[model samples]
Target: MIQIQEPKSPWEIVHMDWVTALPPGGDRSYNACLVLVDRYSKTPMFLPCHKDDTAMDTAIMIWNKVISHTGLFQNIISDRDPKFTSALWTNLHNLFGTKLSFSTAYHPQTDGLAERMIQTLEDMIRRFCAYGLEFKDSDGFTHDWCTLIPALELAYKTSIHSSTGKTPAMLEKGWNPRLPYDTLKKDLVDIHPTASSFKIMLDKARHHANRCMQDSFKYAKERWDKSHKPPDFKIGDLVLVSTLNFNNIKGPKKLKDSFAGPFMIKALHGPNAVQLELTGELMNKHQTFTVVLIKKLQLK
Candidate 1:
């Protein structure tokens, strides 16, 4: 497995992914969410989108919601989703000098940062938008996914992240953002400090955040190294890929084998990922599998 690098600054390396299409919302017609996570701050931005949106539409949302605020990013990590692989997406990022890295096919863990955020957003949307538990308008339920996203994003940003030991908002701003609870506080001390002092505090916060991130990385690497045993399979080995999400295809997933393959290993992509030469039914599908998901086929 490759070591994930820590970003030196917020928004330097952003991970992007899409959530599932839910019951369509009214007027806006938003049925899906575009999720982005900053590698450094672990801040997530959830933008409501329509399931029918084209590549251009996705680009426009990225421009408006992300690029407009943070400017251009240094890198974007994502899975090999068609929306991300399209020519429009490629040229756009190329224009901005933003490097695009795709995770090994069938290995979502490579983009786990954004995947975790997507899971959280999906859960929150189900809770509020699906259940209609949050608020109601004169016309009954709001049924507006777009309206619900901002609050959810804010909640995630303000909550403390374990890896950084600071809330995303705090890491980004060098101080916790004032919330509704603070508005009610009486005799609140002035936080406006002299320019030099403010600079010093910001520096201190960044230093502390960096230290926390380094420790988190070290612990995570150690834990991962402990249980992971590298496979001895080499080139031209036949292997079966774990059929974890094979249900996405048309099939009785439960009745089917939990693993599918015996495909020939064409090449090694990286230390922990392999390129497979698939044939028959699995052809035209994703060809790369992480080592964890691939099992060597031995003669009976």
Candidate 2:
């Protein structure tokens, strides 16, 4: 598990991902959900979408659904989805003051929270559709799964989370929300804030949250450091690069080699990053690969 530190408050650090490639539904030809989660509060938004949605579409969905409500966030964590990796997404975030952090190649655990949420969301949608909710569109195509998504989102928001010991609704709104199952109807109450004291209280809350986050980060770093084997790469050494970052490889993907290789290491860019010397065909395809993506080649 990659131990990433948590942000101090809701929406400060967010995770965006796609729960995808499902059988199409008739409502809007929807086949996937764009999932966004706030790391601190664990509030999640599930937007119904198609598998082929472009990077522009993703940026628009996020701005309309998320930024429209919460204003601007500080950071976004996601996997190496093409949509997230695109230059458009990078520029959009830069225009807002948010930093984009992509999970390392082949290491999904770097964005484990979002991946786990997507799995849970899939399970919820599957169960909801299995309760005899199938329907036919005007053209007689089966339209079963899309309608239950709203209900699943509602239930997920109200349920108490184990990590924070509070429902996302409570953390986001500062109170527990009353569900439809409650016989007694509850009304929303507003509290009047005293002038300077409100700011003082807010400052104290932020201080405490920051302290807790630092402690959590310390524990996680210790665990990660214990199991991590440092990459002992040297200059002028030939290494095999992982194919997970390559998209233009020839031949059937299954038959393709896992690692494209014999690239000589020219220099170390950073502790874990490397610059490789590529000549011939691979030269135009790739230039630099991280040490994590390089494996030692055995000679017979």
TM per prediction = 0.69, 0.61
Query: Alpha carbon lDDT of residue 137, candidate 1?
Result: 42
After superposition of all CA atoms, the RMSD between model 2 and the true structure is: 12.1
Question: Which residue ranges in model 2 land beyond 4 Å of their true spot?
Answer: 1-5, 106-115, 122-143, 184-246, 258-300
Best model per lDDT:
1
Which pairs clash in model 2?
Answer: none
lDDT values of the candidates?
0.68, 0.64
Consecutive 10-residue window with the lowest summed lDDT within model 1: 201-210
Kindly give the stretch of ten consecutive residues in candidate 2 with the minimal lDDT sum. 195-204
- Local accuracy of candidate 2 as per-residue lDDT tens digits, 134-205: 444334445355654554565567767756789888898788776443532234345333423333333433
